[model samples]
Target: MIGPQPVAVASAPLARRNPVAKLAAALLFSVVLIATLDPVAPAIAIAVELAVLPLFGVRYRVLARRAWPLLVSAVGIVVTLVLFAAERSGRVLVEAGPVAVTSGVLLTALGLVLRMIAVALPGVIVFATTDATDLADALIQNARAPARFAIGALAAFRLVPLLGQEWQAISMARRARGVDAGRNPVAKLRLFVSTAFALLVGAIRRGTRLAVAMDARGFDAGVPRTTARRQRFTAADALLVAGAVALGGAALTASILLGTFRPLIG
Candidate 1:
C-alpha cells in the first residue's frame, strides 16, 4: 500500500535557533573576512562553513541550487578582476590595451573570489532555512528593533515567494489564453517585463491593503504589542553562534600564523 508522502519540514535545529543568532554570525564573519584581502582567511572560512552545513541539515542538492547563481557571479568577478585589477608589480602574464594581467592581479582576483564565496555561502545557508516570522520575532524580542520596522520587513520578506508563485500562475494562465509570447529572445524579454510590471502592481496593491488592515488592527499604535509565539534563544542557538565565532577566529589565527593575512585597506 502507498503511504502518505512525507512533508518536508523547513525548520531544522538550525532553523529553530533564533534568527538574530544566524544574522549576527553571518555579519560577524563577513566583517572579519572583509577586513582582509588575503585569500587564505576567507578560503578557510568557506571550507569550515561547508563542513558544518550538513550538521545544520543543509543537503548537497539544496546547497547546489542556491549556490549556482553565486558561482556564476564569482566567475564574472574573477574575469573582471583579472582584466582590470591595478596591481601590476608582479610579472606581466598578458597585456592588452589599457588592461594588463599580472601575477599580482591574478593573486588579488583569487582572493576576491574566495572572499565573496565565503561571505555569500553562509548567508544563503542560514537565510534559506529561516522563516520571516521567526526573524521578525527575534528582531523585536532580542535585538530591540522597533516592532513596526520588524513587522513591515517581515511582511515584505514573506511576499517574495508568493510573488514567484503568482508569476508562474500568471504565465501559465496567459499561455492557456493563447496570449503566446513566443520563444524569440526579444519577445520573451518583453513578456518578462510585462509580467514583472503586472506583478509589481499587484504587489503594491496587496501591500497597501495589508497596511490598511494592520492600521485597522492597531499595529504600531504606539503601544507594546504582544506576540502569541514569543522568541526565545535556546542552547542550540548559543552553540551556533559560538561555532561561527570559533570558525572566524580560527581562520584569522591560521592566516596570521601563516603570514598570509593582508588588510583590505591598510
Candidate 2:
C-alpha cells in the first residue's frame, strides 16, 4: 500500500514566488509603459527589467529568443510609421514620391518601438518562468477566478505542446510519403494551412472530450472543488506587489520630471 508521499517543492525563488505576484508586476509595468510611450521612460524601465530578469532565471539569449517576434514587428512598425506618419513641421530627412521621412516622425516611431519592447519583455520573462499549473492555481486561489474556468485554461495550456508534437508528426509523415513540398513558397503555404486545419480539428476534439470528462467527473455537480496543492500567498508575494507599484510609480514620476511624458493617446 502506498503510505505517505513527500510534497514537491520549488527550489528557485522565481518558481516559489506566487504567479499572482508576477502577473501583478507584469500588468503594472505594462500599464506604465502604455500610459507614457516616451522613449526615455521605456529606456529606463527596460534597463531595470533587464537587470531584474536574472532574478527570474532568464538569460539575455532566452529573452531575445522569446521577444524576437515583437522586435521584428516593432521594426516593421518603425518602417511603416517613418513612411506614412503625418508629416509635421520639422527637418525633412527623405522626400521620395508619396513618402516623406522627418526627424520628428522618426523619433516618434522609435519611441513606440522602445515602448513595445519594454512593456512586452517583462511579461515574456514572467510567462517563461512560471508553470501553467502554478499560474492557474494562483489565479483560482488568489485572484478568486472561477475554478472551472481556471481548470479549463490549464487544460488548454497543456494542449499547446501536444499540438506542436502532432504537427511535427504530421509533417514527418507527409515527408515519408513524399508529399512534402520543399522550397516552393506557395506549396509550403498550402501545407502549413492544411497542418493548421488538422491541428484545429484535433484541438476541438480534445476540448470536447475534456469537457465531457469534466462533466462526468462531477466538476459541474455544484459542489465546491478541493485543490491538490493549496496555493498560499507568502510575504514574498506581498513584497512583489509592493515593488511593482513602486517601480511603476517611479517610472511615471521620472518620465514626467524628465519632460518626456508623452501619453500614447492625448
Candidate 3:
C-alpha cells in the first residue's frame, strides 16, 4: 500500500532525483489545495497532480483500485449529511421519521461530495507515485519530523499487501472448513468481522516477534541513521517549491479579490 519498490523507482532514470524533493513538492502543492475551500483550487491541484502521475508510471487502473474506497467514503458522507444534518430543506424530497430529504440540503451535500472527490483525487495520485521509504526519510531527516513517529507510520504502512493476502487466505480457509454459503448480507458481514479479528491477533503476534528480533539485532533506540540511498536536493527542487508557492499565493489572492474566501470548514 505504500513505498515504491526500491528496484522500481531506482531503475527509472527520473527516480534518480532526490526523494525529499518529490515529497516537498507534493506536500506543498497539496497544502495549497487544502488551504482554500474553493473547489477551483482543488480542481487545479488535481489537474497538476494528474499531469505528473505519468512521470512516475502510475497506472490509472491500479489507482482506481484505491480510489473506489475514497469515492465510497464520499458517498457515505453525503448520505449521512442528508439524513441527519440537512436541517434546512428548501424543497422536501422524502420524509421518514424525523428525517426529511430536501432539495437545498441534497444540493449542499452533493456539493460536498464533489468537493471531497476533488480533494481526494489529487492525494490519491501523489500517494500512488510516492515511495513510502523515501517519504519516511523525507519527514524524519529532511523535514526534521520526530523519527519515532515517522518510523512508526512507515512501519504500519508495510502491512497493506500482507493484510490483503491474509484476507484472501482466510476466506479460502473458511470455505474449506465447510462454512455455509449464500449467507445474508448481515451474516456475511459477521463472518468477515470474525475472520478479520483473527487476522488482527495473528498480525499483532507477528509484529511483536519482529520487534523482538530487531531489538536483538542491536537496533539502536533514538539514534540518527544514515540513508543507504541519500536524496540530494537539486535545481528541480527549487523550481517545484517556487511553483507551489506561486500557486498558493495566487489562490489566496483570488479568494481575497473576489470577496468569496469562504473557509472550507463551514
Alpha-carbon runs more than 4 Å astray in model 1:
1-13, 95-99, 165-206
Alpha-carbon lDDT, every model: 0.81, 0.80, 0.66
Model 3 alpha-carbon drift over 4 Å, by segment: 1-17, 33-38, 89-99, 136-141, 144-155, 221-224, 248-260
- TM-score for each of the candidates: 0.79, 0.83, 0.76
Question: Tens digit of lDDT per residue, candidate 3, span 110-204?
Answer: 55665566556655655665577877877766777776666666776776678778889998998899874465888888897898898999889
RMSD (Å) per prediction: 4.9, 4.8, 3.9
* Error of model 1, residue 258, in angstroms: 1.5
Worst 10 residues of 3 by lDDT: 4-13
Count clashing pairs, candidate 1: 0
Report the C-alpha displacement of residue 97, candidate 1, in angstroms.
6.1
lDDT by residue (tens digit), candidate 2, 144-251:
988888888877777766876889988898889998768999999999999899889988998899899988987777678777777888898888878877887788
Better of 2 and 3 by TM-score: 2
How many collisions per candidate?
Answer: 0, 0, 1
On a 0 to 100 scale, what is the lDDT of residue 32 in model 2?
73
Q: What lDDT tens digits, residue by residue, belong to model 1 across residues 83-139? A: 666657799888888888888888888888899989888788777667667788899
Global Cα lDDT for candidate 3: 0.66
Question: Residue 170 CA error for candidate 1 (Å)?
Answer: 7.6
